[model samples]
Target chain A: MNESERREAMRRGPLHGPDLTLNMRSDPRFLTGARGLIASVAEKIGLSSTSCAQVALAIDEALCNVIRHGYKKRSDAPIWVMVWVLADEGVGAGLRIVIEDEAEQVDPSKIRGRDLADVRPGGLGVHIIREVMDVAEYEMRSPVGMRLTLVKYDRPSPGVEPAAVGA
Target chain B: MADQPGLNVRMEQVGQAVVVTPEGEIAYTEATQFRQWMRKAHDASPERIVVDLTGIEYMNTPGVATLVEALQSAKKNKYRLVLAGMNTNVRSVFEVARLNTVFEIVQTREDALA
Candidate 1:
């Protein structure tokens, strides 16, 4: 295939993300805006500012991973991000989010958040997810994809045992 | 753009005021640094406090909570707290969390000058 022809074919592959979810875009600038959306939903669900912030950071990291590592530098690739505020229909009653991305399978065993001792810029995404959300699950989807579930409870973290509780 | 750390909350106590600046992302990982700075600033017993967020990059959930907690503590200690220099992202966070009504946000460091 010629260069132009290959480019057109890639464009035709998959450009549209799941319309069912909230505003999910590939633009990094819009990430701040997405976090804003999460914070709004979190407030309605009675999330503290800290919890809401964690949720924002967690979602930001997750989406970034999908866009960068998941999409493999493909501009036209699609990533699925869904938000379920006050959703209780799942196996357990709580706010849940299922983020599906069209990328290579992510091995849960190999995933580890950033370590506090290390001051690296990257590698902190997954760690933020695990620390912020009540629970985080990473696994492969049935048909052909990777799925990540993030859950949050309304209860305040009393005497919150903060991780890496030092500068 | 540079993926800078969300905040770099540095504190300096003036004669009767304190100034804080946050620089990087404030997710769960960086909340403790923020907490320490806040704890230290509160210990100074400033008559007025100004938090300058001009250089701040991004702030996650824990950061937001720390700010709220800081604001409340300032109020409790009879310190007039002024938060200024919010970028679009920071402003969006306050607006989303509905803290715009709870804190005093200004346009510049000059506005927060004691």
Candidate 2:
């Protein structure tokens, strides 16, 4: 679905599960606490250890981008994060995280990661977020700023068949 | 020496090489201090520099970026750079960025020194 459609569905609470919402400044010092909280929640939701860490890392990268690129290193700017479990999907359980910022809006299409072959710093955050999360969507907020949504699906252990729906 | 609430970095000379040890999660919050420590290690003008990642259980892109910056400087300045003792999670970040091939990585601090 498109971003507006997804936003509408989220407004209607289409996904049902425990959710956590956070409102904090763009200060990097708060990253450890945020990562720990999300990692704990991911673990409780049955994601593998590696997946839990990946999810936390993805969220951390998103927050860092907001602080660095969006807010331009303004530590006091606001950032909002929402994480929820997707329990109703036919696929295995999944998690969705939404990060919102009120910084200057930019063209989402222009936010591409730099070439990895060049081997440089600073462009890897976007690449890491895309690599770790199943879904990475970006959209401009209503008045200003940007919103990013990241989703990850739980995979069954290696060599084990996924449980049949309702089984 | 560089110390922050979530991260600590210490530098020491081991023979011809300087070993820099950073303990704790190296995220965006600790990137500045980490970079500063690395810069100081470079300025010491050792023939080789080894970053011991044994104490780091977690590292984000910013931390990796700082290391990349150090690697570039090491190349330009004609000093060898080695990374050692990365935990699985920390190593995976390098693997994901396709940086595993770009760095001189070893199993332990002793290996780096050798």
Candidate 3:
């Protein structure tokens, strides 16, 4: 694929394997349900329990970011989450979680956690997602909103340490 | 949305410190209420605030952020905030986020009281 073609494909988000799609209201009440759903999907894909927990936490943070920042804590907004398993060229297998929201688009360059040295509340969600997932990308959806894709390969990527406790 | 049953926080005073024991998952839904409770405890001017996290099974970034805010409040109020009895899973979040070194984490409520 050429550069422009590859960019277009990337903008389409990850389209590999069958996926479980969940349409969630922007309410925080659905967080538990989202976690349960993600956990079940992760287990079905043969992820380790620890890995499942990690993925669940990452998805939870992402959803929270959607509600808190994207929707500005508006519970009536709509959010869609899609999950699937995929195999990379040299990374073996992994799980992909795509979250789409119709809220205002966030600048790609501004999606990051604040300095950890500050030691204060807030701004850790993005950091957690980046640290836990092997591949995380954000794309501006057509017309409006944003799409966040998070992929966690079965094995730890080079130079990236697994964030699991006792690792 | 309606209030979620995922997290329930109970506040009580143990000697000079106020102990807040949060039971169940501390996800996004519960972070707000949890932070309110922590703020209330901090505002009471207790010598210390002990957060007993023994009953927590799951916690995410928002939950951790609540604790971070509470710790900051404690510092501003000149009171100590001690977190105790974090299960491996919950404690792992702090460790992974590198916040474990920034907070006063003890093995148990007794250790926190000490």
- Clash counts for all predictions: 15, 0, 0
TM-score of chain B of each: 0.88, 0.97, 0.94
Candidate 3 residue-wise lDDT, B3-111, digit = tens: 3577778899989999999899888878888888887888678999999999999999888988988888877878899999999889878988999998999999999
Off by over 4 Å in 3: A1-17, A88-93, A158-167, B1-4
State the lDDT of candidate 2 residue by residue for B6-59, as single tens digits.
898889998889999999889987889999999999999999999999999899
Clash pairs, model 2 backbone: none
Which tens-of-lDDT digit does each residue in B1-114 have in candidate 1?
Answer: 123344455778767888877776665446667778877888888887788888777765456667777877877778888888887766765564456777888999887883
Candidate 3 steric clashes: 0
Instruction: Please give the range of 10 consecutive residues that has the lowest summed lDDT in model 1 chain B.
Output: B1-10
Q: Between candidates 1 and 2, name the one with more favorable DockQ.
A: 2
Candidate 2 vs candidate 3: the TM-score winner is 2
TM-score of 1: 0.50
Each model's chain A TM-score: 0.70, 0.82, 0.82
Per residue, candidate 3 scores C-alpha lDDT tens digits across A12-76 of 44656447789889988888888888888888777777788888888988988888899999999
What's the ranking of the predictions by TM-score, best on top?
2, 3, 1
Top lDDT hit: 2
Query: Ten residues in a row with the worst lDDT in model 2 chain B?
Result: B1-10
Number of the predicted model whose TM-score against the real structure is largest: 2
